[model samples]
Target: MAKKVAHADYHGPSGGWGSVRALGAILRREGNAGSTALALRRQNKHGGFMCVSCAWAKPSPPHVFEFCENGAKATAWDLTSERIDPAFLQRHSVTELEALPDHDLEQAGRLTEPMRWNPVTDRYEPVAWEEAFRHIGQELKALSPDSVVFYASGRPSNEAAYMYQLLARLYGTNNLPDSSNMCHESTSVALPKSLGVPVGTVTLEDFEKADCILIFGQNTASNSPRMLHQLDEAARRGVPIINFNPLRERGLERFINPQNPAQMVATGSKRIASEDHRLRAGGDMAAMVGICRLLLDWDEEARQRGEAPLLDWAFIRAHTHGFEAFADAVRRHDWAAIERRSGLTRGALEGVARHYAAARNTLGIYGMGLTQHRMGVETVQMLVSLLLLRGNIGRAGAGICPVRGHSNVQGQRAVWITEKPELVPLHRLGEMFGFDPPRKKGLDSVEAAGKVISGEVRAVFQLGGNLVRSLPERRLLEPAWRRLRMTVMVTTKLNRSHLVHGEIAYLLPCLSRIEIDRQASGPQTVSMEDSTSCIHASRGIREPASPHLRSEPAIIAGIAKAALPSNPRLDWNAWVGNYDLVRQAIAATYPEWYADYSRRMWEPGGFHRANPAREREWRTETGRANFVAPESLEADPDVRIADGEVLNLITVRSNDQFNTTIYGYDDRFRGIHGSRDVVMMNPEDMQRLGLQATDRVTLIAAVQDGVHRDVQDLQVVPFELPAGCAAGYYPECNPLLPLWHHAKESHVPAAKSIPVRVVRQA
Candidate 1:
């Protein structure tokens, strides 16, 4: 039977009444409409909880309603009065729960207590907190230190993340991998090599002063709606916003600020992007090189005419390195190859370059589209190279902004939840904690999964994320996960990860970000670092979902205390009882960035961490920003099809989804409703394949892995995509993404581009 799919060309603006209605719908659905106004008003405000959505920066004096529709949804999702107690678990077996859809599993409601898998009954049974911790500790003690993987999500507060990593290190291993490895690890890896900073150099204020904004491969509307406000304001100020992505997203084209009463009532919208270039999937590198090539050509022409050079020659000569080699590489890039790969004409790229050259200061903003490809690191470096051509870096209102996903994903890294051993200050940590931390580098997400599959990793510890669902190769990982000796998950809500249990799996319910965390010291406040490097306080105003739920810090502390009973130097109890102690320890460990952390967090807009690149103080090996050239113009060189007909598949997140968590089945902005199992193909590609809207098809991954990686029963919908390219929602289509198909250095799954052949389903 054909799935019930709703299709229409959405003519409304990005936000406005649509967003208002969506927010109301979510609130009503969650049965939290009574406290909606209070919860929303406090979101993103000083002394209130941070929006658990994207890592977009909060203004110093935030708006009256500082939250977006998605942010509100997240709040409502967390604050839902629904509960998943012992009876709920008793009603559903693990196997039966595993069969449920991802959305249905989460929608069952928030977990109320710690539960342990009872293999005898195939259901999770309520377990005492102490007993659960003791068993988890025993399981860890039985395994080798390197056999356990401590994984963290982006949801944890700075204190929780710090303690989580500390717990891993105390357990005598450096095997700490977190959500960043999957999302923006490319940026974290590439930025330091190019700009001497892992994070972006720009602040929220930079958007106000930017003359030109270049957005690459990011759907600002769906991924981070708060960013739309910044883009809308920039557009209103006549800033030339150029967007480069396969889809001409409504958020980039136009937005109606729901906060603006007049605009909402009038049903009027403001133009966002001055130009939207629909590039092919995984073509960011080629498009960027083309723009750089044009800029260099213009500079050469200007120099020949005895006019002022278009490039920032003085800045390049003083503050950067490898300009000659980078320029030579750009000049040698074939224009035809660039055009073919980017699916853009020379004239179009030249126009964008012209706008870039005309602007004194430009902000380069990108998302997973540029970071989840095989050449993600090189692509990010190429963007840095583009900014280097005009001295965009280290200048006011100009820099590379990798819009991060989670509110505290950047914070987790800042507090040292990394697989790289050298990134953390081991010597300082030892002095502070009186324990010799592990020096060996650990496995990233991909390596960790491989280890799990190989039976090398016996246990997995997750901090608030659906690791199994978020990762690629769900088929391989999920079964391998069940074979593990132990799996511990500290989360607020029920997810697929809980159902896919190990031999001795434990589900530890923890307090959500919006709940009051009353510790021995009093009602505690957790701090999170925004994408802009501003560390601020997030105080939960709502009541806890259940009395049994503990704060993330408390859960981590309990586990660490049970695991490392003799470690007297590290006061796990003190840290949990008083979060200020965690901040003090964090301040001591990384004094350069977090000194006086607690006091600074209370500042009007929080405190911005010191980014050496912003001051032109290069921390690279060469002591300067490096213009690294990519080896090839193709972002995914291995993405080829030797078969009859193939399309480059780009996995996307719908407006109703956040990472692996599905809020609803509707993608309103794209006009997709009542279904997520659909592939969006270009009109010409659909015709070429003899397919039409709602035509059922199966996408077979074009790989040499011998294993069949395919997603069947995907309905086709015609979209304005480039030829030979199709888009599908992520995780649903994640089966087509092989575990081996990841970025070269960063190991981030190349989910943005997959070579696949589509066969119409009869």
Candidate 2:
């Protein structure tokens, strides 16, 4: 039967899912509204003003049309049509709300008023602002502050994040677990150890200057389509792009820049991928090892011929240490060993090696597609290792770009998250507040989830992010959520994260970034740090969605006031009244680019934070750069492909979707619309099972480890794929992602490498 469509009331799949992030994909998806504003602000402020949504940025003055279909859709998702109000929740029971699908829950709208779960009614009821504030304060005051879990999302602005950390520390706990813990914790944890910078070294400008771009594990065309235009420009200038991923995304295949009327009015646009490779999902480390092996061999051959070697030997001697140890480790693995595991031919590896050997400036760009596996950290380490192999870290056009997911996610970490004692930010937090902070290392996302599961953590306060869907194990996570004494969500929009209320829950509505602030400060502009470590001001160009809505900062201050009424830990009202004071506080603590942040913000293009690498200064302990080889290649974990299972399922995002948010299902990129239950699989796998494309099949995720996960009535379709592999979209398949199945060092949930068996259950 054909579905009936009502005018202005048509319904289908809401295409909202941000980056895979740590939960789904790496920094490889659409940007949330906050992320969009942050990216736009940076682009309007600087040279590499790239779109965070889909890699659409113009080095030569970026424009709105520079963004792609997904980018626009991403923008729309941020400026959503839904509204979350007190009356909405008043009408629905807590259990009933929980029963709604993830998409339905989010589509209901932006949060309008502060709400608390009424124990008697078993439903969330609107609570007065004063009552809400008092309830929060009483709860925090009752518990040992150290036991309270303070969680922040990457989506939160730097100012909000700094304040969040400040409030937590002043209250006396270092449990500052946030979104970074989920996605790039390894990047955060590894890079400081690897190259002394936990963030991407390459700015948006680097994309235009690089001679060769090797994008591994990143599906930029779909994930960040805006980036494809840059690659298109690089291709026009005769630069090479070596793309590596499991699936051949259409976005990477080609791009038609609408901004160019010649191309837009005519047929197709510019091409993106000159050469692409699809490695086994978990085999990036091994694939990279092969490339390194090839480089070393080429270097030796050049030396034998009395020719200068390909490696920047001078740079290594003056800047890097531990090369000898790293070289020794690379020597242990032979070419064949590298190929067998990586599923790449020896020539494919050499082709990449040859390009690296010749290109003066090579940017190794990657997304979460690389980091969400058992070897994700190793995969990222391998990419960084590639840059280090040839002195690419601190160069103008050469570096490892992790392509951060959230807008202010990098910004949040800038002043607040991963607090370092050496930095003045932490010092000022202590000095200004007159409070002693806990010096212990705080729990990360995975560890926090583990803490919640183990019943060590009691309460959870999510600043702005979907905590439940964002975590690894849904079954474990759902129950763990219920165990909490309280779960407070401060969000502008409604999402499944708010629905998964704890036994005691509070929902607070906050101002959207697009809104104007008419506070006592007269008018205020918010500052955010972009991927390249540049701090710029973000002023809302549009009116606020609601007259009653408060800014996120104001909402957070309200929470802080609720948590601590006596002495009011950090002078919440004073700081929230004017964000500049927060900036001055930031400047007082971290005197780098923010020395006179307010004055500097008035200037065009904002200020770039000081990175020693940018100045050709080495911050390593040896006073030199170091390149260490990975101890081992990343092997595909043992997900037994027994007789019953059809193929190993890999979870992916459709072009229309961001991470977990549903705008309305229309994946314009893939030409798939209306539904998301369809699967893309290898023809061989389906043929063996006597099933064709679109055949209904139930994926029984009996992952041999005794963990059970399943996807029922899945419609499988034949697509281009390696014999053993298959692909399906996410959240539908999110359950298949086992909690224990994560990168060894980085507890980033292995959404890519699911050790599951897929089958046709009639």
Q: Best candidate per TM-score, number?
A: 1
Q: RMSD (Cα, Å) of candidate 2?
A: 5.6
TM-scores of the models, in the given order?
Answer: 0.99, 0.90
What is the C-alpha local distance difference test score of candidate 1?
0.90
The lDDT of each candidate is 0.90, 0.69
Candidate achieving the largest lDDT:
1
- Across residues 1-762, which tens digit of lDDT does each residue of candidate 2 receive? 111211121121111122221112211232244544444344333332223243222333445444455545544444555566667776888778877766677656566677888889887777887788788888888887655778877666667787887777767777777766666766765666667767778777887789999987776755666666567789889898888887766667666565566755464455667788877766678888888877888898999999998888888788777888777888898877788667789888888888888899999888777777776776787787778778787878888777666656777778776533443255566676676666766666777788888888888888877878877777777877888888888877777777676778888777655456666787667766766676766565445656667777787777777776456445778888888888888887778657888877555556677777665576667676557677877534655444544465678886656666655554444555566776677777777768875567766665656756776776666666566677777777776777777777767777776655556656
Q: What is the C-alpha RMSD of each candidate to the true structure, in Å?
A: 1.0, 5.6
Residue-level lDDT tens digits of model 1 in 1-762: 436788888878898888888988888888768886688899999999999988899998898899887888888888887889999889989888888889988887899999999999999999999999998888888899999999999999999999999999988898999999998999999999998889999999899999999999889999889989899999999999999999868756778898898898887799998999999998889899999988888889899999999999999999999998998898888999999989999999989989999999999999999999989999999999999999999989998899999889999999999989899999999987788889999989989998988889999999988888888887888899999999999988888888887899999999988889999999999999999999989998988889999999999988987888576667788888899999999999989999998999999899999999999999998999999976688888888744548899999998898888899999998999999989999999888789999889999998877788889998888888898899999878887889889999999999999999999988
lDDT of 2: 0.69
User: Candidate 2, after superposition: displacement of residue 461 in Å?
Assistant: 0.8
TM-score between candidate 1 and the true structure: 0.99
